[model samples]
Target chain A: MSDLKNLRGKAACVGAATTGCGEAPGRNSTELMAEAVIHALADANIPLHEVDGVFAATAVHSMAAMSLAEYLGVHPKYSSGSNIGGSSFLAHALDAAMALEAGLIDVAVIAYGSNQRTAGGFKSISEPMPFEAQYEPRNPITAYALATSRYMHDFGATRDQIAEVAVAARAWAGLNPEAFTRDPLTVEEVLAARMISDPLGKLDCCLVTDGAAAVVMTRAERAKDGPQKPVYLLGAAMAHDHRMISEMPDLTATSAADGGPRAFAMAGYGPNDMDTVQLYDAFTINTILFLEDLGFCAKGEGKDFVGGGRIAPGGALPVNTNGGGLSCVHPGMYGLFVMIEAIRQARGTCGDRQVDGAKLCLAHGNGGVLSSQVTTIWGTEETL
Target chain B: MSGYFDGPGPEAEFRQFLADGKFMIQRSKGSGIHVFHPRVMVPCSGETDLEWVEASGEGTVYAATCTRRRPEKGGDYNVSLIDLAEGPRMMARVVGIEPDQVMVGMKVRARIDDLNGAPAILFEPA
Candidate 1:
């Protein structure tokens, strides 16, 4: 294995933005994505001419990289179109960093945009080609609901405990100006929401919206000139389990069980070192499961760990500080937002919602129906 | 207009592949049980070898969840992960009991249930 430390470069996150989820009256996926890319360049204080590579991530929407590059009017040195579910953006960021380190591309831009609300509201494409025909045709909601049920059965976790996750997330969302679902949600409201899949109510599932987010990566040397306090990418890891839910070793554990430790080891840091965490919360149960899998708490102790206001704003280890996929805008690419929030918090760019002296952040992303997972550790110091 | 469950033909032949004992669950290669649909060839390397074994219907419920809303093709059913005594976990619908009675690590046994007149393996509390 090549030492990631040896591949060191001044990797700086130049631009980051997420289109707030809601009805986009007249925008398609490509149009939304183009606008996001332009905004990201402006945010980074970089010119389009400086960008030499483009990495695009999306689940449902399809726009070729070359076509998008043509639309954006910037011919790049290298380009890639990655489709690895929601985690693709974060994985793309790491890929950009590695490519920059390898001298394949100097400046790489990663972007994700989708009109899932309109696409799903009106009849859009069927499940992507890869998952279209499975023995048990896995739908995200149904697959996650099955896992939620298992968690409840194994841990004696009650409906109230699961609702607590939603409640805490919404509380954080209330503080975030960019969050979409800011209405204060209660345990009662969560339990009472319309059921989509048994045990998984409307509150348990993430929202679908037309939105876009982008991130720019440049070598560490170049980054210092852009953002005064650029957050460095210390380490990254990705893992994939059996694609179908049935083939999974256990629904309670995700591929993260394999990915998380490797990422921490590569960065030479432990979970305790992280001052803040941004876990992928497509469903509230996922957050609880991650709490256990990431070693924050022992297995079956997640219910208890989250019950006593621990994961909330003033708790021991504050999580989802910018709200999560549950209460925040879920643009199908929620992981990108996780990375965005982590960067904002680490840089202390977030005004009131920022954690005090947060030096380390853990950003996790989930792809497919818990099929693929990736974890990235970022900090102020170049630990590697 | 294509419906959700619109299949090319009846799934009876696939079910028979399991009942007649012709179906073998190997740890590796072109074998193993069919847990997910649209069977694809699973390659087995030397590290993970193929082993022929019979499935002991008896197992414990690793996890289970109830569904009130389902695609129009499939009605409301309980989806669960059953840990077979033979050492593999499978996903199937749980039947023959009320929702509240379902518990994790609860004893369960495999039984064939009809899905739209097609027989599919299901689990029930023993």
Candidate 2:
């Protein structure tokens, strides 16, 4: 398994693309997937015929791997769908890296697209396994609220502190032209927003939008020859601690405890080494938890860590520069968007939201009500 | 391996006990540890023959949350993680308090409530 860590620098994410975001009423999931793939291939300047490997988050439409393979008409070797929720795509990226290392396939495409808002909004994960169906926590919102409540009770964090996350998210979103809701949101506005769950207000949750995003990963050598300056994959790791929220070892922690160290250690850096970070923001609670567990700060100091202008643009650490799922497009699972933003940042292509001369960036994904975590460290080729 | 094994097994027996207004958790015959969500085997020791023990129905709230997504069924509902005295934990709702009022480490006792046409376990402040 340690030898697999040597797969480090062998592959790089060469292209990233997002399309059909916001309220696109006409396009369905399939069309959005195809459009994103076309744009991503165009970004890479690689023909559709060169692709062999594919991984997709098929939560929007079930067996989207085979369906996407058939749609694109480029079937070669490998295909997989391990939908562990939003982090599914990063798991796909991690698995695709392993597959590419094993000499199984080349040019992997991890894609996701959904019409959540146009379709009247997302349907929470309802599928249960065995005893889960018989005995279950009926709502995902309630589950997340329980986590926030526990975080507050345990760490003495306050609602306003958590609301600071939303305020920062909108600040970044203000710079993004394509973000769904870019209106400046004050901490007061976030606190004043209607409460959906006990602690999480409407703003604390992500935007429901129609969107598609895809990433193309190929050999680092080939990436050098590609059109876009390749963003080398420095390190990547994925892990899930619990399937059920009740079964999580600790309420305030997540798989980031295990995944963060593995990803950063392989890349030979620490949280302090990251130029900017893009931790998943399915809820504001997630940002705080990820910041703490990923070693940005000590366990319970996340509220203070993000209290000042720390995570906002032009701050010491700019996060979710594309505004993230909070103000950007959260078309169901958002792992793919995380990749797109990381790659663009590494390439220094983000015009306005770009972190000035960001040499290295960390893109993390959280899935299934914080069930799984996948972290990928992407850096400019200069670092490689 | 240990105490009484009723003919119905864990899952069926768990549902049956809910109808009887009783709460039970699986105790490993080998390790004598309690496991929750009704299963046939012990997690750590792989002890197959588990015994059912009636819980004191008394526990403490590990965490609690209020959700308001589904308005048609009901606007909001509170779900909580309750840590039982029997050295196990379970997920259910606590009654007799507003969802916002429930706090971590609050002592609660188990009670049965009708949900979706069947008796389901719930916790109330002790």
Candidate 3:
């Protein structure tokens, strides 16, 4: 779509920053967005007046991009608030890149902020699913538990293997001061946590914390004028199979299969070439499911691939080095933070959690019960 | 499309049928493919030639989970995705057994039951 190969390295993310995460008392989402946008623009050494495009998606505002621009007092020529789920930010990044490459906008700022933890967490605003509403399943968690059950039934993935994901994320979180939870997590502790749904415990779910993140993008030439080294957009792709989990053709698989291949093809790279990975880990099963679907391992091999401390800190393959949503700040929409962490790692700015010699990194975002999957490949100037 | 526009919507019709003690689903008249969560068009073929047909009321559990709730809050219940013998999957609860005992691959049969004071389709071991 839209000649992904031609768009390779045409636009780059010059600045990435996050506002104070975990707990921001008495602050609204718009304030968080404004602060993050200001910080990110300062990181890029660009004035707010130079931002001609705004992109954002949030649960608080229906017209999130417009609200962000108005709050920040900028007149934008281009904007999008398309909410496809948590992966909306990565999708917005692709949209911004297209607009920048087309000369429609010279500077684009994509951001998201949520105070879900300060407010009530996880509201029930789902439209009636007439055909399948009677079952009384817990909206998202039960759906994930259902998938975990099927994966276990089909591939013999054990609870311990799934627990390894949480353990590894906690290990990474211990290195990041911004993480919401940094205590050492063990497999037994995860299994012993209160059961929210069958095959999934409280520890299996992601954190509910107030946070905001933003990224600034510009044309390849303009990025060279920025203060920070540009994290080039090598490839980006997004796809979705079903809106509801029951409608999914296969619970163990996700649309990452389609998007991952296309993104890698556009970048002329493969999974093996990546130095680190950042998967949207809303649930423990998600990491395993994505690992398999994204070509990191064969079908049904994700459980074993993450075993024996493979994905943990200082492991063979560093994944979710910023602790991921499980331990990091997950303020409902987490895709922006996922993309930001990958950018930070690729820039070698992550002091304690950075992967050594990480020239190339991959960030994958998921939304709506594995509904939307967007895979974006990023690299430093050396790789380009 | 043919039958849905006659009276109430497809969803209302399905619920009324269930209330009348008949469990039904939609079938694409041309392709014979079944669909669940009643919709306007055949999702795969985009054909509007749809008609109401009684389901077999027999299905196999494709996946299942026991959602835990406190004892004062209705205790625990099982949520299951059942593969109907007619080829459509739907979400329901597996009854007549412990919530945690509803296993994947178990054969189940649908029956009319009460859900939040409304008629619902619940499943039991076949």
Candidate number with greatest TM-score: 3
Against the true structure, candidate 2 reaches a TM-score of 0.95
* lDDT tens per residue, model 3, A1-384: 466598888899999999869988788889998899999999999999999999999877889999999999999889999988899999999999999999999999999988778876764345756566677767778889999999999999999999999999999999999999999999999999999998999999999899999999999888888889899999999999888788988999899999999999989899999999999999999999998999999999999999899999888889999999999889888999999988999889999988998989999999888899999999888877
lDDT of 1: 0.74
**Chain A vs. true chain A, TM-score per candidate?**
0.93, 0.96, 0.98
Report residue B63 deviation for candidate 1 (angstroms).
Answer: 2.2
Query: What is the full ranking by lDDT, best candidate first?
Result: 3, 2, 1
- Superior candidate under lDDT, 1 versus 2: 2
| Candidate 2 displacement at residue A162 in angstroms | 0.7
Interface RMSD of 1: 4.2
Clash totals in order: 8, 0, 0
Each candidate's DockQ:
0.35, 0.57, 0.84
TM-score of chain B of each: 0.60, 0.85, 0.93
Error of 1 at A245 (Å): 1.5
lDDT assessment of candidate 2: 0.83
Between candidates 1 and 2, which one is better according to DockQ?
2
Candidate 1 stretches greater than 4 Å from native: A8-10, A62-64, A121-138, A381-384, B1-57, B70-75, B98-102, B111-114, B117-119, B124-126
Q: lDDT: which candidate is best?
A: 3
Model 2 alpha-carbon miss at residue A239, Å? 1.3
Runs of candidate 3 exceeding 4 Å displacement: A124-126, B1-7
Candidate 3, residue A192: how far the Cα is off, in Å: 1.0
lDDT of 2 by residue, A290-369 (tens): 99989988899998888787899878888888888898878888888887888888888888898888889899999886
Evaluation by TM-score, superior candidate among 1 and 3: 3
